[model samples]
Target: MSLSLVHSRALLGLEARPVCVEVHLANGLPSFTLVGLAETEVKEARERVRSAIQNTGLEFPANKRITVNLAPADLPKDSGRFDLPIALGILAASGQLDARKLAGYEFAGELSLGGDLRPVRGALAMSLALAHLANDGAMPRDKPGMPARQPKLVLPEGSAQEAALVPDAEIYRAHHLLDVVRQFLPGDTPPEVLDGWTRIAPIPRREQADYPDLADVKGQAAARRALEIAAAGGHSVLMMGAPGSGKSMLAQRFAGLLPAMTTEEALESAAVASLGGRFALENWAVRPTCAPHHTASAVALVGGGSPPRPGEISLAHRGVLFLDELPEFPRAALEALREPLESGTITISRAAQRAEFPARFQLVAAMNPCPCGYLGSSLRACRCSPDQVSRYQGKLSGPLLDRIDLHVEVGALAADELVNTPPGEASASIRGRVVQARERAIARQGSTNQALEGQAIDAQCQLDDAAAKFLNTAATRLGWSGRSIHRCLKVARTIADLAGAATVQVTHVAEAVQYRRALKAAH
Candidate 1:
């Protein structure tokens, strides 16, 4: 009897846990049995690995009893990610490859019947998990220095580039099963093929992130101002307007105004995207903008399942989540966003397991004022009655509205204004101002204005005496909740930062108050 072990990773939310693929070959009945909590796709690898080995002119030892077990018996394994490791384990156990050479290394990839290796999901997540395992991920090897012991990672060509993005990650890309087998041959006998295996080196990047220009929107200065403030301070926004009023257009362009992402932010964002299988190499470091339709359900909006996959909000981490026609979405779905909006994370609890995902997203939601699409529009009269409008707008609960930091009305533009208005400010010009304001906030409190907590809020937002007095009076008159008042203070602080002011003033408070009044009739 012979046994071999190959190391790999299992993804749970953003975390990647280590998994050991164990293969044992012994003289017994000619049957192959797979054990461990493997899903259908993983179990299906039995046929794939068998065919791949045989087609590559390698011995399968079909007469010998085969047993493949994924270690840590309770960890659920899914997808074709285990195919490569399982095949390699069998080869090592059958006395075809050197098993000891596999130490200090991990492998993941799907395999074709022709022995061609295919890309696997969460390649970046797997790389990051290895980094975290090395020295608790305290410092980047490239920045502070690599840990004393560095584990190598092997992946398919399609997925290797994404994994290589991690600084100092030793990533190897292979094209075929034969390519990987060559490395662990019983002895070092120079392989015939060279192109099939190559080390992927991390290259220095100087390219800037590209995004759609904001100059596409023509007018709506007030709505544009709200986007600027939201970008500068990391605040959420709710925009209500009539149809063809540039709500969706403005929401789509909102991501371009945010600051450039740091390397750490880029990794977190990419890891989440990788888990959802939506990550593209070209879109690396560019802030994402997820816009789910109104028909999405609560589970689809907040993320819930047997394994608990990330939802649209988590996919939009470090980016914008644009929900068009917000009031038309299911009431439960809209309400589920309340907690994540405030805490910047969402925890999905299942009967057996629980998973938490990061949802620090900038929400840019839009809606029509009433069922008829226009409640106060001068251009078109609303067809819905008073009660109909009330119920339609009431789909959004009070708590959800309170969590939003800015509310702006995107009014319908007159024909003359739409035709005559030149293109609004370019995204580059607006981004400059947003970056300056963000820098000021980071310098003062080491975070964005919206991230200020209880004592941090009072300590950072230094309101002048008159400004403080005005805020107190306004809160009393508006009947604002404590949450609403704090959000207003943060908005005021952001406004003061944009203007290069040392302290919050009455004018800043007055403008901030206007944002809260836009949705007074909704809830």
Candidate 2:
């Protein structure tokens, strides 16, 4: 046989698109060429594939002309993930292995010069795509004409565990080229099993996170209460405080107070990390925490480029995006966040294609009171004038601040309070309350408060007469927008949840109103 076909997958954003690797051997000039919109790394696969085949003690078909093409040429191919498929194609085309048995399997790996398979990124995404195909009736199942067999996924040994996470897919881990051949071809010698050949174990839960305990942060009781509300509702928060006020510390610990990741959330988060090439397979259910520098560009923050890979925000999906020194970030990047903040997803468009990445992250931002960091400090004298303070505060736009549901002020702790531990609640204890609050929100509204929109908030977050009167008075007096009113209701709903109340009381609405008032006064 002079022709062979193997299946592979190409990553487009967080999605995996199927690619057909076709190999053809002909009586023409002795050369090897790769076609179908291959990028530099993919084009260089010819050399890697050739060397890998020869190193495996297999015939490389030196005198024959060989052509390999990735079908669906319009989609750009950009990685060495095609190496295993290309090598298999060459072996089959050279009559060294049977290609007939390779039909239902998808192969992805980077090959070392010695034909050892190296792990590639996005294995989770590829497995997910295959799983979706099977679920959607797109995969061929055993029927009258079709043979009943699950689709096999061949991945690098290091990535087998991640791929195996998907049910209904047979995962085969390959350490070397010969292992692949032995698995598919009859009478072929099986390669030696590697030392770490056992199935990949799911990521272990951390006995304890590195975050600071709420008990350690003295004073700022109101700020801590607001943090609980934000945690319960999955709402974005802004903390304004002078230096050494524990603003950043509170934000860092917010993630620990969040509910544990569900299986679906873990899979979605894992898939996003896989696409970003940062997923640690051993840490399966751990949520991500992204804290990019304030100097990061819009592309770095929101995800954009020539090929359009995910950025910090997308990497923080189902996790936290903590921005310290919030006002220091460039205006453009901060403004670019407005859309994703509202939609819970970011869309990056290139001339060729547009990709959407999930960014349902909790935004936790902290900023100093002024450029000198002592505008409201009890210990330090203010160094900046009114103009400087105004300019510094103005760096954060009103519209952006409006989207943030909770605005907390972390006041400086008293000198005596710093040394005395007041026996505050630990993160686990706070997390228990947060989990209960979230359960109530989910049970009552079918979503988090952050996800509530126009009608949904009205339907679920109904306030009594006194609560409504207080909110209306506050809105009129504070000049709050409709969006701000809705945000306040969401925050109040969260506050009610934290208090273990079935309804939003007058006091809950009053506390939510205070957070907004404090922010308005601070600016």
Candidate 3:
């Protein structure tokens, strides 16, 4: 009997855990068996490996017992990512290929029956894991700290660029089973490095969607100001408006006004996309924007399954998660978001493994004031009664509303104003102010105002006596919780930044107070 081992990775949430693929060939009845807690897809790799070996003009060990095992038997393995490593292990065990050259490398890819390599999900995560493992001196080597022993990664040709995103790691691309074998086998000539596969292109910027600019929304300057504050602070916003009031349009433009993602933020966002198999490494850094329908289930919004995966919130990490008709969403889904909203991460636990995904995203939600969409409209009449309106609005629980920092009423636009107003300030102009505000916040607290807490807010958002007096009185009368109060201070800080003010002035406090007026009054 001969045994061979190769290293690979399995994704558990946004992270990749090391998996060892072990293959043994022994004298027994001709059969193949896959063990060690593999899912059905992984167990089915026997036929694929056999066919891939044959297509590569290699001899399949027929009329002999072939057993493949994925170690750490308790942790369930899913997907065909194990195919490449298993095939390589089988070849090594059969003495057809050498396994010594594979020690420092992590292998990942799906094998097609024709021996071609197919891309697997979570290549970025796998690269990140191997990079960390290399850095930690966990990889096997003669010299424990030798950098050459840094875990090299072999990925499907299509995923090589994505894997290359991890700095300081040598990435190899393989198009087929023969390509991988030739690199590790002594008598076989190594395949030439594939052309145009070494360098990964910079992430492409998303094309600007045709959204209504902030300049187009006329009147309700207060609402616009609230939107500006929300954009500047990265705060969750609730816009209660009547029908035809441009609430959706205003919310859509919010993305354009926000600052662009930093390289680190972009990488983190792209990492989440990689796990979901949505990442195109060539254009990997675009911020995610997810707008799930209100009818979305709790699982669809928060992420859950036998092997939990990311949901819309995780997909929208480091970007916008706009929930239009907010109250119309399933209550369970909305409630499930409360944890991530506060913690900036979501942990989904399955029977086998627990996975945590980043959920740091700016939430922009909109809803009508009432069921009739005209609860307080100036131009139209509301047909729903007070009781019915109350019930409709109550769809959004108070706890959920409490987590939102800014709430502004978007009243109906005057007909003449809608027709006559040219686009106001372009998105670029508004984005400049938002960026300035964000920079100021980052300089003071190392994060945006929305992420500030207790002492951090108190230290950075110190209010003048006049502003303090107004805020204290408003807090009492509005029944603001501690979180609401801190959020108000953060909003005030952002407003002050937007105005280029050095202190949290009374006017900034007053504007922040105005944003909470509708929510307080409704309560």
Best by lDDT: 1
Q: Is candidate 1 or candidate 3 better by TM-score?
A: 1
TM-scores for all candidates: the values are: 0.96, 0.95, 0.93
Best by TM-score: 1
Predicted candidate 3 versus true structure: per-residue lDDT over 435-493, tens digit per residue? 89888888877988889876888898999999999999999988888878888888899
> Which segments of model 2 are wrong by more than 4 Å?
144-149, 186-212
1 or 2, greater by lDDT: 1
lDDT of 1 by residue, 341-378 (tens): 98999999887778899999999999999887988898
Per-candidate Cα lDDT values, in order, are 0.90, 0.85, 0.82
TM-score-based ranking:
1, 2, 3
Q: What TM-score does candidate 1 reach? A: 0.96
Q: What is the lDDT of residue 313 in candidate 2?
A: 90
Candidate 1 has its poorest 10 consecutive residues by lDDT at 138-147
